[model samples]
Target: MRHLMASAALAALVAGTAAAETPKDQLIVAFNMNNVLTMDPAAITGGEAVQILNNVYDALLQFDDEGRNLEPRLAEAWEIAPDNMSVTFHLRPDMEFASGNPVTAEDVAWSFKRTLTLNLAQASGLKSRGYSAENADEMFVAADPQTFVLNLPEPGDPKMILMYLTQAGIGSILDSKLVMEHDDGGDMGQGWLTNNSAGSGAFSLQQWRSNEYVLMTRNDEFWGEAPAMKRVLMRHLPESQSQRLGLEQGDLDVGLSLAASDLKALEADDDITVKTETSAGFYYLAASAADEKYANPKVREALRYLIDYKGINAAIMPYFGVERQRVVNSKAFGALSDPGYALDVDKAKALLAEAGYPDGFDTSIRVISTQEFLDSATAIQGTLAQAGINAEIITGDGGQIYGAMRAREFELLVGRGGGGQQPHPDSNLRALVYNPDNAQEAGLTNYQGWRTSFFDPELNGLIEEALVEPDQAKQTEMYETIQQMIDEKVIPIQPFSERVVTAAFQDNVQGLMVDPWTTRFEGVTKGE
Candidate 1:
């Protein structure tokens, strides 16, 4: 009976392998995520959702594989007005959305208006300079169906405004007719088009099985070079172990969010190819400044000193790319770096003493329930413990934890920030740290109620100046000052991690380009 059982198990494994290796026609990419809220290009914000959406939609402009700005899908040529407040785009007249409807300036205007409205409603986490609801209504006046004009309130900096439009969350243009036709009237809300996309992108969704798989086929009517692959199969494998196993067993051509430990072993395999890029993002701890104990600057500084970033990076991600002192890209927009605080246990202790907590304080570190974040929080807990700080680690669902952070439910929390292509420091500060309006219930990225009078005024001034300044020299100087200010004050501590690490079977995959600013799928192709 034991021999028979062993034989049966072996045969079962073989059968699974045969099924997994069925064909190269469907490009199965596994990701550690559950069912996404919506696949609509505009409404999608989470990491996994973006990955799936990129496969279906194309933006107005695209970032090259090297992270540089490039033109590909929608607009053919663009010119900025002499005063700098306006931009004119000549659209590609032949393009059409997945619905077979022509892509026009009206669609672009409608999409911009929807984003502006969503931003005003605080329903979506979209940010753009000179493109708010009020201005979008006035600024984006369509002169004709194929010609688009943007009139800025003030003479705006074209590059910065361009940066805003390129954000993956807002760049996708939706068909106005489809959106109006599909309003669901609930939390997913009156935008059927938000959950379902109709755009002039590279691929179109053929089938989506909730929590199971999403299948996409190349858009033969694409304006540019048609992809060589036939289909893209995205499987939701929420378990990290399962995703890793799928990659190893040749069942999945690509796997995302693989465990840090699994990366080393995967890199050793000759059949698989691995690539990683320094994410323009950071992992950091958010302490509730509203909390009585943490409101003290001394307490915050003490916690900063206690963190052993070097030790944590070495243990957690040995192949970690960068070690950030302040927030990632702290030097981007003229923010100052704080030279006073460094890794010093004794200094942390002394600061704790100065803060009226000589015995050290006990607090909880809240984190989203994910294996990757949990591992990172556990390492931090140990590091802080060594400094005499008692950190109780708590894990909960991501939505619940996000709400808790907003409600100031925990003393400290582990979170990440800066996931856009805009390399400017002002962009990061305004969206994540300085702007208080962003903390409103409707705002998307501002979970932590971080505000300081000094930083707030400074950021506002920078934005005002950046909008009008066309001189590259002056813009660079202003951004440097911004970075210097933020870094010196220790507003946020930036830790580093490999941003993009994806592997796929080399045999059938080609044009697998990853964009640093946003995940893109324009060039990806599967075997013919």
Candidate 2:
């Protein structure tokens, strides 16, 4: 009924414009903008908010929409020191903010410094690398108007360092003068910039009604070629059916968040194209090591065979995510081939017997109530039952489900695997498996590995060793070894499907980014 209501309203708008075709000057993209909690780059979480910022901000460097290679953006070029302890970037001159102030080295320095000082969602990437408020001044240095220096704490790969900064966290440079002018009681202008933009990107935030829609207008003074669309509208349509209806009725140009069924139906419909991209992150089954039932590594290994990977991908996960068993995202370097393990009930039973659970046991799987997660958990429950493991499912919204997972209070959980914030292997590995401190009092639960209480001192050592290794070839080898180690160790969390972003858009809406991480409307053009 919610979908029907949204669809009916959009249909009425279409009826009002019966003679006009899809507007070429504006693009209406409807998606569930639940992840867009804040527009402030310092505090924004997840890929959805970053994608929105991509339109309004320019990073010093950015992974292309494909997220395969890092390319220069705000900065024209950069050079790394032989010791790999510092990188100096040469910024593109004659650049101006949307407010028409010159983008200087001071703005670049202050922008990054402010993020760390605020210590919000983006502070982890730098803080984890030994950069702190005390050291931030020494770390981020501005050489001149067009020159900037980022000093590393130790020797590391320049490639990975550049890749790390490519994330919206450290990379989204702000206009120092404009933002500071809007500062309310030293709040860093976060409150004001929440609805406004201060960057020099192709578009500027015009208006944003939380959980409703965000409206953006093209910046005529953009340094690069202006986007074809004069205005961009991202509507908050949570229901996939409503998005599909809007697209079919020509009310929406692109539907960013659609269910797998919606994508399948749209593919069969005329004047719509469904595009899927294997993006960062994964949907995985996690067994908490803190639970006695899952504490045994052998039990975790046995449970891996109970999943029907192919069946899930074909019938349920397509256009939602893909079957990928590798711990790291396949798009990252040194990602090993999937160790194909078909569902073997007998093998699972045999392993259970060997682990002294021949009679099997009862467990509950926790999952968010989203359709795809619930569907996957239901399938897993059925398979586990076949192996004599009676599993009950506990479903809730993200906060309720993931909140428990974060508090280290679940025996089993089906949750999304984060990392893929950047294309680097360390980015995924660190988030998924790296946990240096393990004591309950340590409060290191932010990491998935730590949240699961899956701690291995050696694995932690390897992660740190890999980060500082200046040799790319050697570092890649170390990561490959770490990947194998995690797999062989039966690292409590097992990834089943790599996330894939699927969207249905009008056939004439060209260059829509499927990867939510790098999505932007700057290059999107409408055609006949």
Candidate 3:
């Protein structure tokens, strides 16, 4: 009965048919929500979770529509200390949560501390910048009822810390009192938060069924601009064909997970608009340096020349990514917008011969069974074959593929990585290049550099130096030097393309943010 009603309402929303529970003012969006494992801010990962949480939870800061600049959210104003050791944020006065509890500085402090105390997925952003549970009290403090102060635990970039906080769900400030009331045996409300919400954003979670759908209702107690949509129904329509059908039949207001072909077809629809934006991360080819064949720098350099970046971007990466050779994304502050490497079978074969592999060795490429990944791997396999390298493609689910990479067991893999969420160079460099410990038991699987066994003390030192550099001009120069160093050293990871996200929405909807990191449904509205 509920499903029938939802379908009827969605159809009526655009068809002007009989009304149901879903009002015309409500929004119906379809997207693949398979990655939304939990509602707990600290435990949630991926852009889908962040997209939902952005409306349900208000973070200290938020990214602008472009996902480049930071704007005020819960924090009205923020300032970094001259010493770059601390950042203070001034909260707006007279704020209240959905329960009418006065939003206080203690709540903000507790929320930040909770992430570290739980040490969940979201805590890594803070942990990478020297924050820990031991120093939680000193690092995250409430100076007053309307002020929150974040003190750096070590020499690091305060700007990066602010950028980390700008990620909606991860850095969300929770209502401590409400969460504590649901705490189960010092679990810090993890179990309860997995199903419930304790936030002060423009919307509140009404219902969520795993891999089914999520329903959010507007929060009347919201202190900021009132939301336009009374309700938002995010249906778990994973299949692109279903989304296309729904959109074509006037049943879906937005289809976020449509295929490139479907999106191209929808571009011809007069009532639909397709939007695309360059998102964080890179789709690259990585080789495990621990393998004897890939251990030599000459082999790594040959691997770089073997990738047909232009061909891959033009063919398989139409709606997925664009050709980008640099590790740092183009939107970042210190990013270099130049294509450094191209396809050259001759160069690759010469380098391979120099590396003592004139006959070319056999290698296995692990890739996810998804369409884009498998296709990209196949293209690379064809190119590698031309250079006399026999490449075998191994396909599996994300867990089977990335888990092998995390265990440092893969020889070669076509994958997407390089955490570029913070819009800073260190965000990508720290994940893709910096490797402090090369020992087998180091167990630093979180760092891709360690996973691929690419360790350079000088590169690590340079990244560290660049992070703490105060002068903007000198810091940018340092980043340029690091990029050159990466090329000269023939880093294991060769970024062929930068990720780009595409979505199709009804033309009637206004103020829609296409990028998941900055997407907020609050300002979205349906036209009459």
Which residue pairs show backbone clashes in model 3?
none
Model 1 scores a C-alpha lDDT of 0.63
Model 2, 207-306: lDDT tens per residue?
Answer: 7879888878899878888899888878888998988888888878888888777888999987999998888789999999999978888799889999
Best-first order by lDDT: 3, 2, 1
lDDT computed for candidate 3: 0.88
Report the Cα lDDT for residue 29, model 1. Answer: 69
**TM-score of candidate 1 on Cα atoms, chains taken together:** 0.79
lDDT, candidates in the order shown: 0.63, 0.85, 0.88
lDDT of 1 by residue, 244-330 (tens): 677777777776656666767777877666666544556667776656777677877787777666666666655333456555354
* TM-score for each candidate, following the candidate numbering: 0.79, 0.92, 0.93
lDDT of each residue in 377-429, candidate 3, tens digit only: 99999999999999999999989999999999999999998989779999999
Best by lDDT: 3
Better of 1 and 3 by TM-score: 3
